[model samples]
Target: MGQQVLYETPQISIRYDDYAEWLHVEWIGDQDYESVVSGATKMLEYLEQQGCRKVLNDNTLVTSMWADAAEWGGKEWFPAMRAAGCEYFAWVYSSNVYSRLSTDLTIQYTAAGIVILTFDDINIARLWLQQM
Candidate 1:
């Protein structure tokens, strides 16, 4: 699907795919709690603006653990995103073991309001989001 860049930084890039009606968020490099929150907040804004229900959250380039933000992501951000109209989430895991652990931690605290699937491959994640 064709996409338009909604936001970008050294740490993250948020893109809107109008054709598929989803937000594609790529989180790059090491991330701390602050960077995760910042990137997620920016993504939320674009998701609301674009009226997208699905999110392809790619963490393939993330190199550090950010477990400190896991609870906040699952408890706070996910709910707010749901409230903002999100329904499906496809998360592409980081290859780094620590980053993968952090991603798993976030899922532990996530509620059942939305459909969420995690994948090791971005292509698989994209396909899942497209199907949703």
Candidate 2:
């Protein structure tokens, strides 16, 4: 499936795949708590607008872990996204060990009933979500 850019920022780019009914989020550079929240919120908004239930979040390029944002993503964003029809989430693991630590923490709280998968390879992530 192909995608079109729905929103773009210096730190992140949000794209939508109509055929797959998924949102493709590419994170670039380091992000702080605010930017993390804002970018994710923007993606969720676009996901909802597209009436999609899946997301492919490529965080491989993120240089640092906004650890503080993990709690917010868990406590806030995950539920909202799930409510907005997000049933599947596929995350491309960060190469940085520290970033992986933060991602692990976030994974713990992505909420129950939602499918969450993490992959080292982007193509694997895409293929897994594409099955949905």
Candidate 3:
């Protein structure tokens, strides 16, 4: 499988896998609302440009709370992602309790039209995306 980096920052890295035809989004270090929104917006843009339907969202390295972005993620970003042709979203949770709570909050706010599954293991997330 070939992968290309679509976007990268200290806070996030987004890559596209040619063989799998999915986006691999890795969130790094701490997160603030601005950083989360910025990274998510970029990911959405790439999903539109690539016309990919699946995403593997990895947050295992995240260490801070970003609850502030939760509502926006569910209410705005996710809907935009869906419109951009996204079908499957596999989110790997961070070990941090706060980060996990934030992830749960975002999921709670999300609507039910798209497939969004959460996992504690990155490998499982990847496997799920592959199956999709």
In the order shown, the candidates' Cα RMSDs to the true structure are 0.9, 1.1, 0.7
Name the candidate that leads on TM-score.
Answer: 3
**Candidate 3: which pairs clash?**
none
True-structure Cα RMSD, model 1: 0.9
Which tens-of-lDDT digit does each residue in 52-112 have in candidate 1?
8999999999999999999999999999999999999999999999999999999899994
Q: List the residue pairs that clash in candidate 2.
A: none
CA lDDT of each prediction against the hidden true structure: 0.92, 0.87, 0.94
Better of 1 and 2 by lDDT: 1
Tens digits of per-residue lDDT, candidate 2, 1-132, equal: 578899998999999987787899999988789998899889889987999889999999988978888888887889888889889999998898777777888877667467888899999998899888
User: What lDDT tens digits, residue by residue, belong to model 3 across residues 18-97?
Assistant: 99999999999999999999999999999998999999999999999999999999999888888889999999999999
TM-score for all models, in order of appearance: 0.97, 0.94, 0.98
Indicate the worst ten consecutive residues by lDDT in candidate 3: 106-115
Superposed model 1: Cα runs more than 4 Å off? none
